[model samples]
Target: MTLPTSDTRVETTVTEPGQRLLTVDGLTVSVGGLTLLDGVGLTIDAGETLGLIGETGSGKSLTSRAIIGLLPTAMDVTGSIVWRGQELLAASPAQRRRLRGTEISMIFQDPMSSLNPTMRIGRQVGEVLRRRGVPSVEVQRRVIEMLEHVGIPDPERRIGNYPHEFSGGMRQRAMIAMAMIAGPSLVLADEPTTALDVTVQARVLEMLRQVRAEQGSAMLFVSHDLRVISHVADRVSVMYAGSIMEQGPTVEVLRRPAHPYTKALVASVPAVRTRTAIADPLPGAPATPADRPTGCPFRTRCALAHDRCVEERPVLRIVGTDRLAACHVAEEVSR
Candidate 1:
């Protein structure tokens, strides 16, 4: 994603009532020789879902880690991550920890490890309450309510079961309850529905929506599945090789995508019962951070690449009303 120029950030996007609860500005993440994220920026509003979609190895998950301060020690991140007007990256570790799992919670992809094998689900969920100094009676009640909220069949029984005792889908529900029990304002859901039966996936997603609706929590949902992202996200940001290629309202960007990469990605989703279907996947694989093209990281894979694409890096300039893309040829591509 092309980052905001220093001057651009000075002119903050016009803030409506509760325009943003979280804003990441010109964030860059590097691990020794590799630049995992290059100037990625995004905003998640209160009570909104922002779908962050990208292909595998595109740094989608990495971006999530950087937000929650879960990246490995080797990676150095520089940028401003503001939550409720307080800078997260700039905050002390103790301060960040205080905010995490209470003000901001994240549902990690793998539920097995996320939930301790030895701990019962109820205890894990109540741990947050304990840390917050809630009374034991209230913690138990909240844990049971959370279990039921995620649609576990037998909430009371399942609450006492260890992680290993629960099935995959059930384990996921437990994880969701744990992440959400604190009633965080922002929830980072990193592919929480992947690899589940279609029916179960729908249920989980619906549960996320309900959680947001009932609690008024904002969400940043990361996924490679554009289809799934489109279903849950109000706004969408498409990423490629650790940068946002295009971003706008979900329907607008998907219907009239400005970037060549976004167009290819939308076309590539496998649909049901389509005859003579052909997915025009982008021509070349995304480059590693170290070897990105001089002018455009996506230039080598773009069908509309020109000499200038290889000589002058394209910034993510606004092309449409309320939309941004990092492609010199977006205007012509739309034509």
Candidate 2:
């Protein structure tokens, strides 16, 4: 396998003290004897956004779920989820519950499922405050403020509306307001822009960017859109099947990806046509997690796959400064 040469190495600076917010270390997940995640590691620093991009079924959503303790009871997790020096994965139920809304929050992918149709929009957002024993009056005040903060114009008139009463964009805004009501320090957004019109998609992306900047929360923005990730991501991680294929600063990784799967994903973006005057959508769908080939899950689709690639699995290792890639043909890919 192609490993980083000594000359290619560059020293990395550790961020300022007390800035590390969330960490997922060697996180492994299995369901019904099927390994869904194979030792994924991610760290989100305070006030930075990490965009995780991949095709569907690449375990992006599962990584989000695993962090929030929302993974199904049928699955087993073997790893540590540390937050501010505490091991959250092993925290007691009450401790986990306490940390959930006050310290960490998740804006789920689907607004329809995330919201309560029976609950008024204002009440839904206020639930977080109420759970913390804040007075009802304060909850109402904070919920309305959040509604206005999330770009729901004239929030006072719409506070009583239910989920079904609002348009898709409005509903999504409300969901954002709810997740962020308590002013948590970390947010996980899973496909926050899916199914929205282009204009609304841009608006929602702007809203998320605003909240993260104003609140200074570390964020993990998960999606399939490299173009969208390019807009708001400080760092980018390209995932394949169930493992990270390549990761680095957004600009560097996007411009010179060292993994074939990552290159294929970037080339498949429709917007790439406008810039490069050509597009090559990745052929074939992703391999199922349960049936991935032994050597490398992506070898079947990689253009440069060789005999060694098909016979031995490649592990993620340093390829450049602040960069890691899992591919036997890393040198060929970089060129």
Off by over 4 Å in 1: 1-17, 272-278
Residue-level error in angstroms, candidate 1, position 303 = 1.1
Error of 1 at 162 (Å): 1.8
TM-score of each: 0.90, 0.91
| True-vs-predicted CA distance for residue 247, candidate 2, Å | 1.0
The CA lDDT at 245 in model 2 is 84
- How well is each residue in 1-335 modelled by candidate 1, as lDDT tens digits? 11112221111123343457899988999987788899999998887999999888888888888888888888889989998889998899998888778878888888887889988889997787788777787778778877776778788788788989988888887788778787777889998887477887887888788767756778999998877887899999999888988989998888888998888887786551132466655667778887877888888888789999989888888998889999998898666
Q: What lDDT does the true structure give each of the candidates?
A: 0.81, 0.81
Instruction: State the lDDT of candidate 2 residue by residue for 1-335, as single tens digits.
Output: 12122222111222342399888888899988888988888888888899999998999999998998888889999988998788987888788887777678888888988898899999888887787677887677777777776668788888899989988878887887777776667888888777577876887777677656655667899999888898899998888888888889998888888998988887877574256657888877787777888888898888788898888999888988998999987877988
Note each model's CA RMSD in angstroms. 7.6, 8.6
- Least accurate stretch of 10 residues (summed lDDT) in model 2? 1-10
Clashes of 2: 0
State the lDDT at 61 in candidate 2: 94
Provide the global lDDT of candidate 2 against the true structure: 0.81
